[model samples]
Target: MTNMMIYNELTAICGENNVFIDEPMSHHTLTKIGGKADVFVTPQTYEQVADVVRLNANYHLPFMLLGNGSNMIVKDGGVRGLVMYMSHLSSVRVEGTQLTAQGGAGIIHAAQIALEHSLTGLEFACGIPGSVGGAMVMNAGAYGGEVKDVIDHVKAVTPTGDLVILNKEDLALDYRTSIIGKKHYIVLEAVFKLEKGDAAEIKEKMADLTYRRESKQPLEYPSVGSVFKRPPGYFAGKLIQDSGLQGKGVGGAEVSTKHAGFIVNKNNATAADYIATIDMVRETVKQTFGVELELEAKIVGEDLTETAD
Candidate 1:
């Protein structure tokens, strides 16, 4: 189909207001760097999301799902087909000790809801900057708690746009990884099993975690928090610090002085600059410690040079 046809179809499926052409990916990612997306769609409902997925499948168009873009870095060349932004689908509900949150609901917001209901299990997630779906995809966690520990089940749409309910066992959640991405499942909702606890205690715990995060992380700058996954027997931040990589980077992108694990957009950094900084850190660490540091942040889209070629 032509670009016009695709736009019209997308508008028909969603609405004209929900679709955009040549949308800036920098506006959608945490790093505040990237080019543009050929098409971007904000689906307000689960059915709309499913339909958008099906449409992309039918047209053989490439697509990527976006939550809060908390852990993603889009490249300078931007993305080709569709970019589905799910933030509008956010909704959280509580019943007894079970908290059900829509895919787009902020994980932090869900934690707050749990606290409001005197739920304790989600206290650790109070500082995680991700959407429920994104959290489920990577089993996001902090302060010695993981999403897998509290998630009971998830409702997601498969790559074929068919919905499926997956129990915790089927999710295959591990340290910063899950089957959700491998299976190309777009999360619709998640059910968390939390324990009832004293609201005061929960609030206190959340406050403590928040303080730790704000104090340690480079929250003032734009960044894809925690650049590398922790290697066995060593923390990524400690390793980066040991390598003396902190306070250094390419262009406006720099390894955060506050936390070595973070690569911040200290100035108006380009995606290339950010990626180059990541590479420099990775190479430096590999040479220094003989440890291959795997990335925690997801890199997407294409580079500007590639687009020009």
Candidate 2:
């Protein structure tokens, strides 16, 4: 089938307004640097999401799932197939001591709900900028807490378009990674088991974490949070700082002066600029300390240089 046929089919499943062609990836990401996606669709319901997946599978079309777009980088040549945004599926509710949240719900909202219910466990997530599904896929955590520590189960749609529920163990969650990250599973919802606590204490803890994040992170510019994973026994930021790489850049992308961990779009940066800056940082760090740095962000789409040739 041609791209138009796929677009028509998607429009039929989701309303015409929910489907877009040649959508700019920059508009969807936190870094505000990317090319375009050939197709973009937002499904209002879980069934609609599953149906899209099924249709894509049937057509042998390549598709990618996106959450809050916090930790993603789309290349300059753009994504070839469909990019499904789950933002429309956001919903959150509480059941006793458990918080059940839809995949598209902002992860911080779960912490807010926990605060409302005087739940103690989710205070650590009060400042994470990603969606619940993204958090589950990456085992996102902060201030000594991780998603795996609280998540009881996760519901997702497999690549084959089957909806399946996975317990905590089945997720195979680790530091900044999970089985979902490795597989073609689209997270639908997550259930977190929390404990009742004093609302005042929970609020205080959340406030402190929020303050710390604001004070330390370079939130003034566009960035995908931390760029590199913490290398064992060493911090990525500290290494960059010590290497005198802070305030350095490639094109419009710069190593944040306020926080060495972040690569910000200080000027009008392209995805290629960000990639180049990242390469520079990794190479410099490797040359200086002999430590290989690994990216924490998910980079997708095509390389413009390769495509141009």
Candidate 3:
């Protein structure tokens, strides 16, 4: 399978501990479904990531970046070549009201960091499960607050391995997108400027938001949170509910009867099953509203062979 050659190359670059062969994506992904990545590499620093990129260029090996796996789905057939997980890059530092987060830092963790610094702007992310890199790339927002609103600048490695800093204005963040993820830019870190607030008040607000999220969302189930973006004036969940798609699905991947927005893997659902349910929901929503609801979650990798079962 040319596995040895691939392993040797990876081990030569990042050593044995950092490289994993056929690592299961099910455990890593939020939905807890899918096959394995051919090779999974978790680099601890931006320099290591850059080095990996350079190695990929040398070997002409295929590769892709991964964050928290919240807003994404890898098909049941699994991903080919190198899958670089950003989790190892976690670091969050607050200097006064300004915060700097390593790309792989969870938004929830970043929110906590902000709270520890008595910062108020990151309260919206107190409940988010995505990484700072993914959040920045997608211009992630919730409850009237957005990453774009607070992010002052970002540091990233380009496709050609050039490190650069892009200011907030340069990111061109809007809606659910930014230049980084689109342009194939690899985010290394992000700097956010927040406001000083009472630490007690910040903690109280975060707690309130967390409670509200737990009460409203399907927190117990394994699923990608918020399957679709808000479509202009209408909420995606509301539209699906109004269309009578609540609790409907292709297999074990059922639309949450609790929320109607989330497609949860209630049983041992396959990524194929999850995707089939996603398709059904989209089609039904399109037919009913003629709105052609867009998926917020990123769907990638090869299609499944035994998809029906």
- The local distance difference test score of each candidate is 0.93, 0.93, 0.88
Q: Give the TM-score of each candidate.
A: 0.98, 0.98, 0.96
Runs of candidate 3 exceeding 4 Å displacement: 306-309
lDDT of 3 at 40: 90
lDDT per residue, candidate 1, 104-207, as tens digits? 99999999999999998998899888999999999998989999999999999998899999999999999999999889899999999999999999999999
Over 19-112, each residue of candidate 2 has an lDDT whose tens digit, in order, gives 9999998898999978888889999988999999999999888788989999998899988888999999889999899999999999999899
What lDDT does candidate 2 reach at residue 108?
97
Candidate 2, lDDT over the whole model: 0.93
User: What TM-score, to 2 decimals, does candidate 2 have?
Assistant: 0.98
Q: Positional deviation of 110 in candidate 1, in angstroms?
A: 0.3
Two-way lDDT contest, 2 vs 3, winner: 2
Which runs of model 2 end up more than 4 angstroms from their true locations?
A: 306-309
